[model samples]
Target chain A: MVTMQNYDNIEYLSETIRVCIKRRFGDDCEIANIALATLGGSNRTVLFNVVRGSYPLRLVLRQETVPSEYSPFLPSDMQYRVLEVVYEHGIPVPRPLFELEAADNLGQGYVVTAVPGETLPKRLINSAEYVTMRARFLQQSAEILAKLHTIDHVLVPGLSALQESSDPLGAQIALYDRYGEPHPAIEFAFRYLAKYEPEHGAKNFLHGDFRNGNMIVGTEGIRVLLDWECAHTGSVMEEIGWFCARSWRFGRVDLAAGGFGDRETFYRAYEKASGNLVDRESSRWWEIFGVMRWAIYNIMQSHGHLSRERRSPAFAACGRNTGIIEYDLLKIIAKEFD
Target chain B: MIWSARMFNDPPNASELLLTVREYIEQLLPDLERQDKYHGLCCTYLLDVVMRELEEPPNIGDHSNNALKALLNNKDELSETEFMSSLCASIRRGDQDGNLDRLLILLTSHVSKKVRVSNPDYLDTKDYL
Candidate 1:
């Protein structure tokens, strides 16, 4: 469970990674460089370059550093397996290279080949360099999501570990209640969603945390969907709802589809790609649920900081951000638009 | 006996002090490394929250609770936590279904008041209502 905060142990990390590389690429392979990536809250991501014979290979090592009992993520090994299955299905994902062995003493994690792209939402949506990408990501992501949902869950072994919620709304409410911090807005949302719960659709393989910030965008379009930690089996609309949540829109509230384009364009593309009709009413219901889910997620993160499970200024700020998200949730549920 | 009071102090009040520190951090942010800079930005943002909270009246939460009480038709006085917790429980139990409109207004106001301090930038304050 060692985090990047203890970079003083770089020598130990270097040796371990060197051993890992040597095992895969012969003893002549040498670790050229390793640096800790600053993103992600639950996992430690180390970017490293290896010289295998005369070839230079770039790869990323992702480890579950701080495990939360309340976390909804699948185990690290499961995420790796999910990556493997998705990559094999011709999905645009980083190639899963190898996993950390128990004897490695670095906790559970795996390595993947690094792909070149930007994951920052603000830059991708607003920067002139990404104007073409901004126009294309909505359609591309829709197609990817549609194809992803069609994947056979049975193809991925041990997917039983993923929670297949019969009552997704109720399960989320249970998680919200566990934190025991009452927000009238979130509570009101819980009531609203329950009263108008849509008929459940056929369960599909969903990328649980699919959204703007979780995607890798290149100049052409979405390079890959990242963060399979929240992958689960649920209603397909759950993924769409999460994508259109106002929180994921960053600052561009108008472009609700991951702040890329209008929901109409995204929904139409998904229909064409998946050959399934888009249910607008059901999607909107999930959108409200998505907002409430995100607000509760903030509380969980802040609790992580307060309880000393792990402390970071970013996590502490999430406590106050919950109020802002609550404002958005109330607005959406009330349909109060400008 | 009255405690000695100074007409002026060497430093300013809480809000002004926080503003000064936040400005210093913003200026120092560019020189820090990537991770340190991100943390610095978060620190400055938290300081902004503290400054805004200091600017608000200390009894803002009590006012919000009173609004909730009136909307819920409760006459008894209750602490902020008690009011919010009970209201939340009632909503979950569907006891407040008939009063969704009134409850929505009250809840929106309640959340907006907090956002005004937590981060007013999130709201179009000119016409948040």
Candidate 2:
């Protein structure tokens, strides 16, 4: 229920944030330019610059918003822990600074060093500066995911406590049914998936929301794989297939690997990095499942707007916008039958 | 008898009215701030959808009902909502596993018709139809 007005009082936030930073970096720290981030829709992101003696630091503060219907079980502190583990293991993740104390009055949230790069899909795919980077996009994504999947759940604290589902298709069906809304396209897709469920592979760490928009692209390649809120212990193919999902392509349907490269190139890179064979059939199955999941998510987002929990034009448009996804789902599923 | 019925009571239909409002908002967009401009663009897009709906109403209800009846192989006179719910339940129970070929055809046609109303450009770009 945090309105836009709650963030307007910069003075109150600056005072509270200053105390949190002082506790972390000593009493000589000063916080400035704390304002809302423009990009994310689910959480409240505040970017600020901190000065401690002669050193200047750029950091981001992420706060939890009112829980939407699709919000994952991983809280901000749990995500901070996951980031800590990922960063320590040489993954390109923003360094976790610290979690806010109860006295900070910022509700539930944490801070991380702000990595400088572009996360917008349009710029990453079409911009002149990223032309060369686009060539290595798929390979780099594969390498990162391969490395991420190798992380030990026991070593990474609190990761095992996060939900794990062996039957992802069943879980998705239960979720759709719980929504109490009938989507014929989604039901049809789910039925298709159920009848052709792929063989389950070994469970591994999954970057739940690994896609074009979730990544921060730099001149070299992916600077950081962001948004670990959906991270879970699942099949490696699920992560690979989620990346190749058409919805994540963002209108550049020609390039299947997040609009960067073909599916073969992506699969090859992943195999090279993980030392495991990639099954095309399994990946395709997950891709179809990913599309259906996204369509359901769109419906949930529109409901959020309709129920007045969150009011934004973007959310309101999702209900009708599902048509395009439905079309894509039918096309992919039909090809399998053929 | 012909003169008794009034013709052209309103010159502009619902579609025309929506177009006029959308045009006015587009004109005022340049003066608005960044956030307001984005919201104005969304409003314009919504109005465009409304105009499309008015010009050619989508036949989703009829199409869905027909698809459901074909899947169940029954001609029960059920409401669109009820029929879809029953079909979904049947699908969840794996009733369509043996007849996937038929279900696939029905689903494809159903979604294609939906895209025609919501975003026909999808079909044109993919060359699906």
**Interface RMSD for each candidate model?**
1.0, 1.8
lDDT of each: 0.81, 0.77
Query: Candidate 2 overall Cα lDDT vs. reference?
Result: 0.77
How far in Å is the alpha carbon of B57 misplaced in model 1?
1.1
lDDT of 2 by residue, A163-265 (tens): 4445677667766666688777898887778778888767787768899999887898888988887777778888889999989877788888888888999
Report the alpha-carbon TM-score of model 2 versus the true structure. 0.87
The runs of at least 3 residues in candidate 2 whose Cα sits more than 4 Å from the true structure, single-residue gaps closed, are A1-30, A38-41, A51-56, A66-70, A157-164, A336-338, B1-17, B24-41, B58-64, B73-77, B124-129
lDDT per residue for candidate 1 within A52-136, as digits (tens), equals: 6688889998887556467666778888989999998888888998888876666788999888789878888888898677768
Task: Judging by lDDT against the true structure, name the best candidate.
Answer: 1
Q: Give the DockQ (2 decimals) of all models.
A: 0.77, 0.56
Give the range of the ten consecutive residues with the poorest summed lDDT in model 1 chain B: B1-10
Reference-based lDDT, residue B11, model 1: 54
User: Alpha-carbon error at A61 in model 2, in Å?
Assistant: 1.6
